[model samples]
Target: MPQRTNNGFGLVRRGLAPALALAFTLALALMFMAESAQAASLSSSRADRRAARNEAKTQAEEVPLTPETFSHKLVLDGQAGSVLSFTLPEAVHKGLELTTFQDLCVFDADGTPVPFQLRAPQGTNQRLEVEKELPYFMWQPEKPGAGTPGTMDIEINAKGGIVRIKGQTDDLAKPGPVSYLLDMQAFFDAASSPVSRGGLAFADDDLRERAIKVLLAGDEPFMVSVTMKTSADLDSWTSIGRPQMLVRTRQGDVTLERDTLVLPGTAKRYLLLQFADSDVPIFSFAARAVFDKTTHEVRETIVPGTLSENKRQIGYTLPGRFPVTAIGFDLAQAEMMAVRLSGADDPEKPYAQRASGFIYRLERDGVTVTGEPFPVTQSNRYWRLSAAGDIPFAAAPGMRVYWQPRELLFLARGKGPWTLAFGRQTAVQASALPMLGQSDVQTAREIASPPTDTGATTPAVAKKEESREWVLWAVLILAVVFLSGVTVWLVRSMKK
Candidate 1:
């Protein structure tokens, strides 16, 4: 019996050895298959990503513009030889896919694309020159508590003239025509005029006209009339006729201020200002000179927004992708509230704060004063308004957005009745071409044409790619299942 058992054990051990070797061989084959499948999948994914990047890079140059690919079309009228320029209307905002209008295309009657350039509205250029915080010395009557003629002793020589005026130690406490002498020597020196050295040739034409802006700090609102005089020589002064009024008054939340006084013509080296009203109790004042010159012209468009609201804030959805210049609110009732304005290009993205200020509509004594529109230069599709505090709105206010539409300058290539096509998700961006000079271009009139919407086209290439991926996955799955089944069968046979 012992001999028979030993023979059976030897036969079992011999069978087990062959089964283990076969199982090990099968395991190695399975691992190699899995590795090959994984490597292929990774390579395919990498290739797809690289192809996508390459397509995006060249799409602007390779893709041709077609009428059927866009959702909106407008007909343009101009001669073939002339370069045409047109300002994009607010209606085009709804069909814009890119903030920079890269998706916009112009095609002639024969469907051939034309070279175009986008630009801001052309206008007469203007520049503002400001001289902030001009230096001034206060002067008062020479004799204290006595009615006497004010004496100004001036010493004049070749280099410069210096004026010495005697007055009380506390000149601000006295009540009279408070005088201030403004030294314009620095302004003359910077203007590069001979007048600074007392040669007396007029300054540059750009600095001929100037406006003085004054900021007053006082406890109460006051209105006063001022007399201005200019002098090259301290002894001989020329009076500017007519007293200008400076006023500051507040009613409720609205403050009305008029502190700027326009000068007649070119100013001299010295400026003297005399206040007429003494009972107003003037405390302190600051002044600046502003020079404005027309530089270029600007064109803008204002569009009304569709209002929306949530539990936290109110929003305005603009129809077009606009480079917002300013935001205004139309309040039906007289109300004042501090609010913050925010904007975003996409609704899914967080709104960024653009501007924050108090907006008010106040009425008093049969006059209404509305706050100026908040100035903000941003490009966005959606805007939101939130209260600075927990202030609630009784009713929804109207919103108006102001933006300067980019001008499109295109060569009138091919034939008549050119079309502007826009609004496509997969369409390639149009390259910006060199724009012709304004003098060389003719203005093109836009004819309102109903946009044709050929519904979204299905991408056959994407569908084919997806099908290929599915086939590769199925083949990998089948190989894994076959290897697993074969391994299981071998284990069962070994056991038997």
Candidate 2:
């Protein structure tokens, strides 16, 4: 009976090992399932947010600014020293934050540009009492200000400059009361004789600034009036500026100068030039088409360079793959040069001339400007330049990159609450107007819980997600192997 009891106890002990191993394996499987479900939940949330952002981006609305869309046009009587206040409508106040004075335009009744200084937005104003309001024109009589009471129009337009491309042209022969300065100078020998009159038509109506290049011969001094006109169709003409007088006379034997035309900033397809009857022969007339410069946030990047065997070739590797706009060089020696860009890591690859152009350097009046700023067509990680001379290593060379940021402003037409979504290129979930203000704009460490998880996920979050999946699988696999070994041991012990 005692022997039988001992055998029974041994059997029980042998069975206990397998039972505990099976129990341990079951717990590991359950934990893995829980972890897998959690990972899936996070992934699903990310996908939903990404899909939402894509849908929102596809349906963005754009509003074209025109006179027809103005909510109100205020016409006010103006004088030289008049103190005018403009009270912004409720819509403008709620939508925009007036950060600078470059957000408005003032014009006169005759469509002439009226220049006025933006009165600083003050905290205390007894006049209009509007919280987000600014004092209107601080008029000056000498400039583009109203000398007397007249009609004034205000509009919402940002202050920006027009791109002016100037070139000299000798193509000034027309059926007008004008003769070339060369002809007049040869005939009369009067160094002061200006070109009688001339007319040259622009290829397009976008002309912003026009100037006649004047080259004076000898110490001849004379005054001449210049008249300009514009025609949209080349048939009908409208006078640009009243005949303005220009004088050219000095002790120097020769002089080269430019007389700019004060034309209004408007579009005109054809331009006519009339020179005041002086004996001075005109050199050339230059006209620049006015194009509004696009304002963008610029970022600068530095790239180190290595001089090649020939020493004239400088090779560099760009740090990032960002689209490059301009390549800058801090030259120890200034020389005329051109740059070639490529993506090849090989040093032997010959330079291509796909986007190559002349580099310019000018130093006058103690100011020096040198650069070759060109738009990039394709992205390249490598760059080589064959300068007129060898690029000195001591001079630091770099690259200026302009990134087209992945951001945009959308104006939704419909009333009430609006939502936005974007970004499938990454784990970041989505975006919206109001949600962006809280999550993106406000730098709070903790975001107001994302609406539907549209915002993007950080790289750290994504890495942890991947690690969790691997860890869960690893635990399950290890539990299975351990349990199988324990079962084998228990069976062997029971048989013994």
Candidate 3:
């Protein structure tokens, strides 16, 4: 009976082997199912992302001027003082080129339009790893001042028994208004010597009033003309000058100050006394000058140029397709010349006349006193000397183009691959292609993940999902193996 019972137990244990084996196999199958499902889901998600990115690229509207199919060059004489112009072909805007590239060409000997390759300005194209958006303001059309920012005039009334002198002060900056009281009774007592009383100090001997200033009260308009002298050491004095003030107004408007006597020398501190033909009581008066507040913000950017010392002419070219509203040079001396911009749309009628006037700088006693600011306006390219003359170019004459850059629009079409072609013509062509596919994408800053409603998948999210799948597969594999080993051991023990 005992042997029979043992055989029954053995039989039962033997049956358990197949059952355990089946269980192990089923566990493996389930793991495989999990892996398959994860893979399918990942693949579907990736496909959706790709489709969305492609669609966004197709609809991308804000594209910069592609250098590959747009830019061109012309052959014209960049004479020192002769007008040159190049008009763009109207055919460029006929197609979707404006949204892609604009075609520009120059005429050959037979007036046949010959297209030239595009060359981008050096260091113009760049891609950063982080997203960058800069905010800038556009300039509204500003009406310039009628004359200058600030004006000063001296008026003398000798016939009215009282010398009534008046002044208008628009310049309220430092070195502005300096007032002094001149007692006529004390002038006679000094016996033609230096007087220093009542905020007024000056030498009466050989003393020429370098400048006379008048103060304007509320609604009291006055204009005065007075000879002024300026001295650095109070021993040497020079005459005031009638030169243009090369400076902007307080509102940041650039214009020339005309018919004004500029102070001599660079002395911040000086003394002033009025010069009168008669014993007139020039008792109390004030003076002032204006400085631009915009100088600190809208500073000048010097365009690249090459100067020839032999020819005394500066060869300069404004880089890129960006238009400049104002084009001028930093002048070292007073000069007179003309400027021109060249175009090629109409070969017979090709140049726009810009300036045919004097560029003046004020100097007193061979020292820089003051000057007029450069005129600012016009959107032009290929500007050169419009008149015919050989003015010696100053050493290191900086050619600067002042322009308020237009604000740009960058469409956030998710992040993947983007291609940008710039630099020399050949390089641009080699890297250029129709805006399609993931073949050549620029390394721009990773765009932020779109809103959840857009059903967008960011790179970060995809990587995280893959990691979770790997972890789940590993955990399931280890659990199955562990359970299978335990089942096998328990069955063997039952058989024993």
Candidate 4:
């Protein structure tokens, strides 16, 4: 009986092994099912976002050029934390080439873009990544006049936490306004001179009233103090500029001062500073002569305080160095680029960020914007607009822009702002010309011809005027005689 019981126990132990193994496999399968369900939920959320973006694209195509969306139709489509959508219209769409890679932009509430992934069209061409060769999408419109529409049938998938879209489809044939804002930043090189801010409290009290010349070395708007230190001991000086580097910013706008005249007539300088405080980055600059009045003459006097000693000063400290930037804009296109502002030979700094402000090219189909001299040198020159509803290239993010219907030319740098100004005179606004340091401005500031107390016009000028008058009289007389003869002939013919 004992032997039989032992055999039964062994049999039961062997059978239990297979049962336990089966139970363990079943538990693993259940866990996998739960994980898959969670994954599907996430995917559904993304699909919903994508669908929303597609809907926005549809609306953009349907809408026309209204005051509301004149700026751009594609502001993000969802809530504060949701995915964004934008519509790329024709004006900005000129540069998109579906042939190669994709354009990566930031999706934001306003027109600003946040970091995002631009997916390619599904079931069609595979999306190519430029990450290795170019990292980011550097906008390069085909050479002016060379811009041609790229192949249609393109879609963009904007993704950060969520995925959204904007692109061209056959139903939406007409290219709308390019609907993406760049994170643009322009600044002055704080390194060259002491990089101090001037928008609010300028270092020197006299700076506010003192006229100072500015030259941009970068796209950033910054300040520097120039002291006409005295040389009583042959090594000291005092501040000559009142409110030195006294920069004025209205809200996010920057108001600048300039003593270095580009010329006494028709032109003044304006420094562009459109950044908020506590915002710092790699600096760059551009210089301008902000005029006090529409006459293009913004001037201030910084009375040099008493120089403790007669022999205390070495020399008059020239006001702040004039920084110049070769900024360009296009009114028709409503786009602007700070192109160049560096210490290097050409001074062309082509980098950008969010703080950079925009300019408007007040234009009339190649006609000079602002009526300032648009020399042949700047034949290819253009400007951007910033007034609200005027167009994208015109308005500044901080201010409400009231546009002047006439085309215009505007200039700005990193954080350099644009304003909504009404014409103060016949040609109320003046275009800021591309200046080449003081050397170039010296010519513009100089009276075209010196004004003499003699009150007598230069002999050469007088002669030319007299000759012009005589020629005008002669032409008038000829025209009258010709008209009389023709009239007489016509009357005779009618009588016959």
Candidate 5:
């Protein structure tokens, strides 16, 4: 019995060792196959992304300006042999896949390509000098009998408008210097006038240095030294350094005059002009604020956005890829709320904060005051608004996105009824063509036309691509299952 048991155990050990080795080898092979498959899938995905990008670049470079290639079309009305220009419609902006409008082209009735140039809606940078007359009132001493100047207590409203001005006297019967208060709010409010509207629109840094031109119309030649003090709320006053001398001397033919004063740094809402000598004679003078306005002609398109709620935050997605300039909100109710605006090009990626501040739509003094649009320079497609605190809206607020439209200038070459072609994914930017100056070209009228629907993929092609992906996945899954079965079989054999 012992001899038989030993022989049987030896046979069992010999059989188990081979099975164990086979199972180990099969497990290793399965792991290697899975790793190779995973690596290939990753490599394929990266290659697809790169190929898509390269294909877009190639399309933009090689695609011909044919009506069939573009997804949208518009008719141009102008004479041939003349350079024509037109502002791109809002529909063009909505249909464009490229930010720079590289797919844009103009073709004649004969399908011949026309040379063209793309320009900003607003032409180029232009510098303008704007001057506005300031309203002023003089302050006098509280006691007329007192020979000394007295201090003045001034009150201002929320809009920085002066509400009241009262003179106060000290216990010693001494008074403060008499001063002239000028309403400097006109320089800060851009919407006050047409000329000043563009003044503050583009350049915020240029508003720091304000030029005050004073016109003194007095018969006698007088010299007076004046000191300027600025105040936002009449309570706090900031002195603008040393006093400046204002002199108007008369010579034989030429008159020597110093009438301009430049205030450095940020300007306040109210400016107080005080004379150095209290005994200086009161002269009739007019003062105006001068601003160096730099403006760029910009064409704006406002597109309504779709709103969605994401947990505590609200998000918005625009219908098209827009070079967003500003964001405006339409509140459901009159309320003030502080929100942080964030944006991203892709919805899957994290959004970056663009602007943060208070926005309100309030009714005050029988007037509706809506907050100005927050400025942002991004071409992002997704936007989110998060409340800064515990503020919650009664209803989902409506949003409007503002963007600048590109201008197209094309030379009319073949015939009438030219068509503008655009909206292609693979199209590249066309080479610039030198044509007649804008002053010499006539503005072409844009006639609305239906889009071409060139981006629609056929059902057959989509099915083929889908099947190809499924086949690849199925092969990988089968190989994994076969290796797993082989590994299990070897383990069972070792047990036997």
Candidate 6:
């Protein structure tokens, strides 16, 4: 057939025979694809047999099994619970024998003698000594169990005996695994510093009673303020007129117990205090407080900073005297509660410093706070929250966030709700704003019995009671900062 073609059509038609053949080839590829898929359904029978044979050979090999008269070695490589077990006949009596009753052999990581003495079989002595040069452990049963060879349990009893096996099982004579253990510290004393005595001064009467306790914790020092007070509850605070001890100072190596805490309280729920300037390295601070027989629930966190070289003063003034108030927190929970007060303080003479404070609700849900999601408290980071009326740990529908008229952080947790005060010489003249009657939940426990004179009736003492009020006001005022700045401050302050 003569195919009609334009000049271009003829050029295209020149390969027509090849084009028809190409279409046939494409059809052939599709048919072969199905066969390729079928081939994928199966593997090489010879390769499969070889893999099965290799696995079976591995299973047949014994894991270094030996008769009761065997001495094997193992390396721990610092991994916890990497144990070395050996099966031996009663004939291997050189090492301490272990039974379901007690441990067989014990050795410290530094190759020291433990208090325990291994008791072996009735006729033989169980004593295994470390073979010098070789890191292999030598052990024999102190006493064989009732009726089994390897079935008997080997128990250890001196609290917990950790065996630091070094090197590899094959190379027990040399070191291999270079692993360290966190458990190396059974009970490490990780304290920072402790202070006992130093120089402290008081202006007024130079009179104060101070109980200082220095704790070695975190990489910094923390302090809590306590007033030698008298109260029925451990909440309301009142300053005493007579200075019991004036103040406490530290000048030597600090111990754990005698680390004098400026504040006084056996309660574990401690108030952590630190410096305002985060970089201030505190050599030590003096805690000054007036002690009275009838004072109660009176204390403020005392933090010492720049005392050795610079001016030393409390972090807060009668709010407004200075522009900022410094607060602290448990150095551990720095994220939870940290605050400072600024913008108020009375400076004039006869300076009747009235205590000032902000009243906010301690709202929470399970473990989370009401509005502030992040555990952060910087300037203006607070969200307005409704102050639910007086309620226990239980949340209720009636809870509404309303601004309290009171200025101080004294409500239900301390003396009386309205009886609380802040930064004042006395509770009577703290804030100008009067507080509403505190719900019973805020009142602290009253002192059971005040110091009584002969035939004299003791006055009613007040304190903080058990309530769900966990306000961050105090923490905000005293940021328990660590002396990470000591590296710098020590060099500058110390007149070496």
Best by lDDT: 1
Local distance difference test scores for all models: 0.68, 0.40, 0.36, 0.26, 0.67, 0.24
Span of 10 residues, lowest total lDDT, candidate 3: 131-140
Error of 4 at 396 (Å): 33
Per-residue CA lDDT of model 5 for 1-496, tens digit only, reads: 3455545556557676776677668767766766676667667766776776676556546755577677777888887788888877667777777655676678899887878888766445444455667766676556553332222466556666765565433332234456677787765564233343533343544433456777665556767788888876665778886788877788987788887777655557777777654444444443343334544444454444444453347778777666678888877578788888999877899999999997788989998999988899877878887788875655557777777777788888888788887776654455576645557788898665554564632112112334445665677667667766876675566556
Clashing pairs in 1: 93-320, 123-296, 123-297, 124-295, 124-296, 124-297, 125-295, 125-296, 126-295, 126-296
Give candidate 4 regions above 4 Å deviation.
1-11, 56-496
Of the candidates shown, which would achieve the greatest TM-score relative to the real structure?
5
Please identify model 2 stretches exceeding 4 Å from their true place: 1-294, 343-352, 360-362, 388-396, 408-496
lDDT, model 2: 0.40
Give candidate 5 misplaced runs (Cα > 4 Å).
1-28, 52-63, 123-310, 334-338, 349-352, 360-370, 386-396, 427-438, 449-496
Q: Each prediction's TM-score against the native? A: 0.50, 0.27, 0.25, 0.19, 0.59, 0.13
Give the CA lDDT, 0 to 100, for residue 190 in model 3: 34
The collision pairs in model 5 are: 59-426, 60-426, 60-427, 60-428, 122-297, 122-298, 149-175, 149-176, 150-175, 150-176
For 118-144, candidate 3 gives per-residue lDDT tens digits of 222111211111111111111111232
Query: Residue 57 deviation, candidate 2, in Å?
Result: 27
Candidate 1 lDDT tens digits, 433-465: 665567888999876555555463422222234
**Cα deviation of 146 in candidate 5 (Å)?**
18
TM-score of 3: 0.25
Q: Candidate 2, TM-score vs. the true structure?
A: 0.27
Rank by TM-score (best first): 5, 1, 2, 3, 4, 6
lDDT of 1: 0.68
lDDT per residue as tens, model 4, 1-496: 4455545445446554554455445445544654564456556556655666565545544643121322212211222332222222222222222211131122222332233322211121111111111011111122433222221211223321111122423232122211111111111111112223322212222121212232333335543332221111111212222223323233356545332312111111111121122222212222222212111111221212112133221111112211112222223444433311112111143322112233434457886553111111111111222222322222221111111111111222112111111100011112233322322211101111121121211112112334444554565556556555655554444444
